[model samples]
Target: MDFRSLFTRKSKSSSIATQRLQLILTQDRFEVSEDSMKKLQIELTEVLAKYFEFTMNSVSMSIKREGNSYVLMADFPYSKTNKIR
Candidate 1:
């Protein structure tokens, strides 16, 4: 009977679904064979770490279906300290 509860449940469900869909779509676009994605993830993480000290789990880099083509989207947290080096 509470609208707030309904909204919260819907929001959580939608977020989970979106994340799941995005992962699947990304895997599909990259044509990442089972072992390949694992290799790619590791290599990318190492490369990124060479530049900054950040949590690998906190960053996401992937190729996704956008319109008729696939697009690579990477998200990283920025901090003012990065400007120094």
Candidate 2:
């Protein structure tokens, strides 16, 4: 084994295919356009990033139907490396 291999650390991020599938599912379930969804995500990310530390693609947004209304749910997982200053 190469000595450098032992010292190198790899980031175990989610697969691109899985992420793409998730985006498609979210858009289809919510009846949202891909462009609109991405625009909203980016705007929200900009606002929240000012206060909290989160990875760009880690944010998940979904719409849930509740009887006569729908609820928008957003989840932003904090980044382990970026801390509040």
Candidate 3:
């Protein structure tokens, strides 16, 4: 019996399942979901459009770990070159 192969398969599946569970729990705590995040990005683009110009994928946001806590961070590729006035 190849115990190594059995152990490898078990661990791989376990790791993937664990990661998925963590993602679900984290998203729950944050009160957000993948669909909501996409909607938020689109809405933000529309609202910010009146003041700034940015192409598709120019803005980004995500929840990430920083030290011991998770944070929702957003980025907007900013430029005053094409500011709407």
Candidate 4:
């Protein structure tokens, strides 16, 4: 058994677990529920669909903590041909 391989594998696994924990903690800290996030995404998609021809997958939304306030961030991929306006 190679000792170095064990350390390397454990480090990679630990890093991923740590990142996931941090994400969960941040989400909890902001008190943002998964259902609410999904609802927001659906509503935003419906509204944007009126003016754009893009797949729901093209829109991405996330909540970011900025100082004492939470910021809602959204990104939409737009193409000239996809514009309904």
Candidate 5:
């Protein structure tokens, strides 16, 4: 018996709603506005674009809480052939 099949699957709308709720909760907990995060992501992408070729969609930024400290994480993918430096 497969335990995975025992639970009903979530609909796409439900999955999207859950993701949105999680984002809102995370932003509230970190005291950061959605606009501010977007600005930060844009600025980071612009700065990194000077040295590498990557699409804006390839960039991701999020805040994480670790013990007593809050950490900002950013991820971007760049092709080796397009490196400027």
Candidate 6:
């Protein structure tokens, strides 16, 4: 395999493979399944939407093991209707 050939390729299969491996490792380390993540996202979105018009597409929730504790992140834009002057 020549090093120059890698630069000529336009495919991102290498990057995809790396991402998949990291996802699996992260899940294993955190002891969380992909399904749980999806469910949590859906439920949280629903709960937030009830009170305010949330931008679901822009929301991101991730759970990862950090040190000895688990970190959970929920990021989304708040409804503009509730903005104060």
The candidate maximizing lDDT is: 2
**Per-model RMSD to reference:** 4.4, 7.2, 9.3, 6.9, 4.8, 6.8
TM values, all candidates = 0.63, 0.57, 0.51, 0.58, 0.64, 0.51
Of the two candidates 4 and 5, the one with more favorable lDDT, higher being better, is 5
| Model 1 residue-pair collision total | 0
Q: For model 6, what is the error of residue 61's alpha carbon versus the real structure, in angstroms, after optimal superposition?
A: 1.5
lDDT of 4 at 81: 87
Model 5 per-residue lDDT tens digits across residues 1-85: 7676568575468879988886786687768888887887888888888888867757776667899987877888766776785
TM-score of 3: 0.51
Q: Which is better, 3 or 4, measured by lDDT?
A: 4
Off by over 4 Å in 5: 1-18
- Per-model clash counts, in order, read 0, 0, 0, 0, 0, 0
The alpha-carbon lDDT assigned to residue 12 of candidate 2 equals 32
**Local accuracy by lDDT, each model:** 0.72, 0.77, 0.74, 0.75, 0.76, 0.71
TM-score computed on alpha carbons, candidate 2: 0.57
lDDT string for model 6 (2-85, tens) is 797779767579988987776676567657788876677788887877776765655675556689987866777776673432
The lDDT of model 6 is: 0.71
Candidate 1, residue 81: the lDDT equals 66
Over the stretch 1-85, how does candidate 2's per-residue lDDT look in tens digits?
9787688686235566777776777798778798888888888988888877766766779876689987789888876676874
lDDT of 1 by residue, 23-84 (tens): 88778877787477767766776677778766665567678667897778777766876552
- Per-residue lDDT of candidate 4, residues 1-85 (tens digit): 9878876745577778988776576567657886776777778988999888878857766567789987867788888889795
**Which sequence of candidate numbers ranks them by lDDT, best first?**
2, 5, 4, 3, 1, 6
Question: Cα lDDT for residue 54, model 6?
Answer: 69
The sequence of per-residue lDDT tens digits that candidate 3 reaches over residues 2-84 is: 76776664557777898887667656756887788678888888888777786755777756778998887778888768578
In candidate 1, which residue pairs get closer than 3 Å at backbone N, Cα or C atoms, i.e. clash?
A: none
Q: Which stretches of candidate 3 lie over 4 Å from their true place?
A: 1-31, 67-69
